[model samples]
Target chain A: TQLLEQSPQFLSIQEGENLTVYCNSSSVFSSLQWYRQEPGEGPVLLVTVVTGGEVKKLKRLTFQFGDARKDSSLHITAAQTGDTGLYLCAGPNNAGNMLTFGGGTRLMVKP
Target chain B: NAGVTQTPKFRVLKTGQSMTLLCAQDMNHEYMYWYRQDPGMGLRLIHYSVGEGTTAKGEVPDGYNVSRLKKQNFLLGLESAAPSQTSVYFCATGSIRRQPQHFGDGTRLSIL
Candidate 1:
């Protein structure tokens, strides 16, 4: 079983629409990170939330960490074609050394 | 600076063949990890090294071996490869301070 589960494996939306991607898990983590991967490229870090119930915003992107630290979410306002990519959420294992990633959400924003 | 890089971006191999994938990181990190990402599945860890001369098994370690002879390089080896091992392999490096891991583009391996 996957430790972290991401919903809406694929998403297609119009350029001015809004969307949210979720990453759920039963295990609690000390911290969680979000990444975006473009085609033929490696994943790049977007944001990291370390506190329970923490919410962070990067321009039009909003990220939330569950109060229990068992889940996280990414929200995009007025999505643009440039925001299209694979979004993945990851949290460290019990030892806080290695990370376990979600399946990922593939977002496609058409212009 | 190349934060992380993998060689042989694409490769095709026949069953029973052996090969090695090299990962180099210029971040001078102490932790390095190997992962394989299959369709419809999240990246699964194969092996990891905490420091030079030390290696440990991750979520999936069978049919794979790794070595960290130097602080900046980690190598993943497969002996007697099988078709089941075909997938996109990724290498990552990170620090212990909760810093996000930086990944390589990935190596597309196909075994027939």
Candidate 2:
């Protein structure tokens, strides 16, 4: 089974601080996606990185895919309370549609 | 658009009982998935259907079953409930090809 390991399982930061979460794996992926899920709700797609070494920015959030296609990262700048949630990274499984998710990084941003 | 909707926002079942979680999508997407999330374990795929009348097992499909009789609806059933099965379940659907999926508010199932 393809497994994605995410580091910093838990994070707590004050507002305006910066934080980064990493997802690494030994298997190459066709695409990698990052999602943020709030309490009581299903996850929402934050970004999808398909190309190796590609970078995409969504406002204050930035996502990067590894050149080898085996890792990804999510960075949040000037964090806000709204950024508090469970951040997950996933890649398409062998079936192509099913995703194998990382354990997750729970972030709590304090004011 | 209602996106995706899962019936019975919350349910509590006893051991050996059975129940089905209904997931309906109005977006007309062809791919649908069911996932379970534990406190610190992230999300694990239980079952999925790529289209109507098709079903496939995911990474953790033990003690779970799924059916997609229609393009817009996927059903997940538990033949016999166990405490280990208790978790927050989410349903998601996407378009014909690879696309960002839209999700539904999850169902919180508790087995006592």
Which candidate comes out best when scored by TM-score? 2
What's the residue-level lDDT of B105 in candidate 1?
A: 94
What's the lDDT for all of these models? 0.90, 0.90
- Residue A12 in model 2: shift from native, Å? 0.4
Per-chain TM-score, chain A, candidate 2 = 0.97
lDDT of 1 by residue, A1-111 (tens): 339999999999999999999999999988999999888777888999999999999999999999999999999999999999999998888876568889999999999
Write the residue-wise lDDT of candidate 2 on A42-96 in tens digits.
8998889999999999999999999999999999999999999999998987767
Q: Of the candidates shown, which would achieve the greatest lDDT relative to the real structure?
A: 2
In the range B30-100, model 1's lDDT, one tens digit per residue, is 98989998876867889998889999998889999999999999999998899999999988888864344
- Residue B96's C-alpha lDDT in candidate 1? 68
For model 2, which pairs clash? none
In angstroms, how far off is B43's CA in candidate 2?
Answer: 0.9
Every prediction: chain A TM-score:
0.97, 0.97
Candidate 1 residue runs with Cα over 4 Å from true position: B97-100
Each candidate's fnat: 0.52, 0.70
